[model samples]
Target: MILETGVVVAVESDGLWVETIQKSACEVCVAEKGCGQKFLSKLAGKTVSIRVLRNKRSSEEFTVGQSVTIGIPEDIIVMASLLVYLLPIFTAIGGAWLFSDSDWQAVGGAFGGLLLGGLLVNLHSVRKRDDVRFNPVLMEEQIQPNILNFQH
Candidate 1:
């Protein structure tokens, strides 16, 4: 499980809307001074809202401003990345191979295959939209320090 900490921004019947900072390792890397990733992160301000499925044990207990941890499975991330990135390349090669007789035909076939691969991926994502395996879920709440503890 990959876990991230976030603050609950809203409570809904089905889940909590959590807001987390969008951070990347590039921000803390020694080479950040010249990294294109750092520049892109700066261009994209660092906050994202995520809809997390409420924990079954505490589904109705969440409140806005509460700190919580959310988790997503590692396999889901890996599979999604593979489907989005490699599927097109593999399909394009297959397509070009199918039209190996002519260079122009191979090029056209490759483009068509890339498009078809992307479309298939999109369709698969839509079909799996509600699959629990791909959804992030609330894991645990963080305990906040009591402000009154410092009072005399």
Candidate 2:
């Protein structure tokens, strides 16, 4: 499981809306100062909002400001990435091979195959949008100093 820490922004009946900073590995690399990726990461916004499943037993105990860790399986991420990227590439190659006799025909076939592959991926994703395996779940809450304890 890959875990991430975020702050609960809102509490819903079925889940919590958590806001997390999106950090790239380059951010902490020793050579980050000279890496092009570091510059691109800066261009990308710092935060993202994700919905995490609320634990049924602790749902009522959660508050908006609470800090928590969310988790998703590593395999799910790998599978999603492959489906989005490799499918089109393989399909395009297959299409080109089918029309190999003519150069222009091969190019047109590859383009059509790429579009079809993308459409298939989109349809599959839409059908599985609510699959539990792809959803992130609340792992555990982090303890923070109670503001009520401070007296001024």
Highest TM-score: give the candidate number.
1
lDDT of 1: 0.77
Which runs of model 2 end up more than 4 angstroms from their true locations?
8-17, 24-45, 55-66, 140-152
Go through the candidates in order and give the C-alpha RMSD of each one to the true structure: 4.9, 4.3
List, residue by residue over 115-148, the lDDT tens digit for candidate 1.
9899989999888765678778877554332343
Provide the TM-score for each candidate, comma-separated: 0.68, 0.68
TM-score of 2: 0.68
